[model samples]
Target: MAFGSDRRDPYRAVRLKLFVIQVGALLAIWLVLLSIVYVLMSSELYRVLDSELRRSAIQVIQSYDHNHLSTQNANNQSDFGAAYSLWKITGAASSMSATYIDGTPFIDVRTVYHNALMHPSGYSTTLQINGQPYRIFDALVNLRHGTYLIQVDRSVGPTQVTLSSLISTLIIAGMAALILTLVGGLILTARSMKPLLASWRQQQQFIADASHELRTPFAIIRSNLDVLLHHPDHTIESEMTYLGNAYEEVERTSALLENLLTLARADSNEQILNLSPVSLGELARDVVESTRPLAEWQQKTITLNAPENHCMVIGDPARLRQLLLILIDNALRYSDAGACVAITISCDTTSCELRVQDNGAGIPQNLLPRIFDRFVRADPSRHRAEQGSGLGLAIAKWIIEAHKGQVFVQSKEGRGTTFTVIFPS
Candidate 1:
């Protein structure tokens, strides 16, 4: 079980922790609020009950005083819709106690009368008789005959029923809220981690690809040096070939390092481009002019087609020129000797489009989706003869996007390829 647990995805644990914290916090707050509400409600109910008991006791005393020793008349008086009992007490003994208006005995006569004599001033307490609860108020009264004790009580059954119902409602609502919060917290935690997981995977892939690309140049340089060292007694004339091979590898390594640096800066958001209005038509013409000699040497033709007027876009001129050169270079490298490479510039009301189309061996359909990913090459060759470090298109895409533009490609195997860059006008 421990071995299996160690192999589990760490992010799942992190997500669970986040979900639990959020749900637990919500439940804690709910419980605190419910406790406060219950305390306040119980206090209010008990306060109202105590006030009613005091009022009933006062009314009974007033009636006894007005009737002047007429016990029957005072007992016959209504208790104002409340349950109460009148008791005549002398010393520790009670006699002839009237029952409550509801015909229920408030308490055991002997026990309550004894307690009333002990506490003559007044007091209120709760009692249970015959499985029913009551709030009892006991007080001593001075009448013309002698001192007497009166007890006022109201059944607390109705109040207990209402409080029980309230408790049930709160419990149900709390349970429902807790369930919803748990579900919602889990969903939100998963959603929030999606982008972070994607970025982590992408970074891992980028590191792996970068390491693979660097190994080739290092291996070439090492092999050439080993060959030279094995024949140390030879003269410079004999060693020239091996030395030149080593020099070429070193240059390739340097170029690869520079490309990696560019990508690193771009990834860190430090590649700040100087923006200005650049004429797309003029830039395309200059690139064609510059590459004309190379095209001639390879027995290939280069052409430029543009609008008559200057088509302008906001961009960093140097970076945009680099972007154009990358596409053109790829085209020239892949095309046959007699093929043609075309640079076209067009503009509409909202955007300017620059396309570099080449009649070369186009990219395979499967490789088109990730063509701009660094260290990804269409050809699967490890040899440096025809393939590059595979960072040119990636850098080009980054530069174009930095200027708030987009790069798109349309290619077919064995037909040709066209790379289109669009900039908002």
Candidate 2:
């Protein structure tokens, strides 16, 4: 079992612990509430029964008349559920007594009368009479020419039944609530862990990719340094080639580290956008003009398509400029020699649209969904040759999303790729 358990998912134990805590807390609260309700209900029911008994005993004593001393019996309980017994004791002798009883067939007459004489003017909160529970009250009254003891008995069977039913209902309800709490706790914990697990896995992937990318430039720098070390006695000009090669690798490494820092700041929400009104058309025009020289040097052409007037949007100008450059760079990198890269900006009252279209070796259909994910590249070999860390599109995506804009890409292998961006105006 130990070996088998060890092979199971580590999260299972943690998840089970959470489930237990959630369900146990809910069950404890339910039991406490149930106990409180039961106590209140039973207390109220018994209080009513006790009050009725006392009231009936008082009424029986008040209706007693000296003029009716010769009356054999008065049936006071003919209209109520309770039974009554009235005894008149004269001179402390058993033979000199008159008794009147009603609806007390289940009671022991002689014993109850004797008890009434001994414990006069009090309540028997619970008394067993012929195998049933009863609430009995006794009152001793002294009037003209007589001493009388009055007894009132009310059965507690109905109250017992109601309390029993209430307890049974609480038990069933508690069980049902426990089941629901278990199921609900499992569902809630699973849902809560989803984003956390995704973030943890993403962080792991980012670290691995960063290490792999960093190792390449470091290896190149080490090789160049090894060459300079071999020619230790040479002049500065003789070893300048090795020094320049090492410097280029250092520059690439610095750029890669800077890009990683920017992404890290973006992920941690530390890179706050400096928002302002900017002209999209003007920005696109400037980026195209500045990048035209590089395109011509690489045997490619660049053009801008936009309205002559302003296409204003709320965004960070610097971030928008970076975003435009990343897309234009990707278009140029992937296009064949002599291919033309086009930038278009248009706007309406509600939204502004920008497009970077290129006739190049476009992305595969299967890779479109996660193309903006960090470290995801369309062609790993080609990107590595161009010193791409595959973070440009990812950074561009973050910039657009931070500015409350949306990006969409449509591409087909060997045909073309068009990136459409929409910014709220």
Best by lDDT: 2
- The sequence of per-residue lDDT tens digits that candidate 1 reaches over residues 68-160 is 324444343335556666665555353544333222344576766667667777777888867889887877777786665677777888788
Candidate with the greatest TM-score versus the true structure: 2
Candidate 2 has what TM-score?
A: 0.78
Error of 1 at 328 (Å): 1.3
Per-prediction TM-score, please?
0.71, 0.78
Candidate 1's clash total is 0
- The lDDT values for all models are 0.80, 0.81
RMSD of each: 7.3, 6.1
TM-score of predicted structure 1: 0.71
For candidate 1, give the lDDT.
Answer: 0.80
Report lDDT (Cα) of residue 33, candidate 2. Answer: 91
Model 2: worst 10 consecutive residues (lDDT sum): 1-10
lDDT of 2 by residue, 1-425 (tens): 12125343446566667667877888888889999999999999898888888787666666655242224344447235577777665655375454553333444545665776676566566888779998787766676747766678789999999999999998899889888877788787777656765776788899999999889889988998998788788888988888897888888888889999999999899998889999999899889989999999999999999998899999999999999999999999888898999888999999999999999989999999988988888876674557377899999999999989999999999987999999999
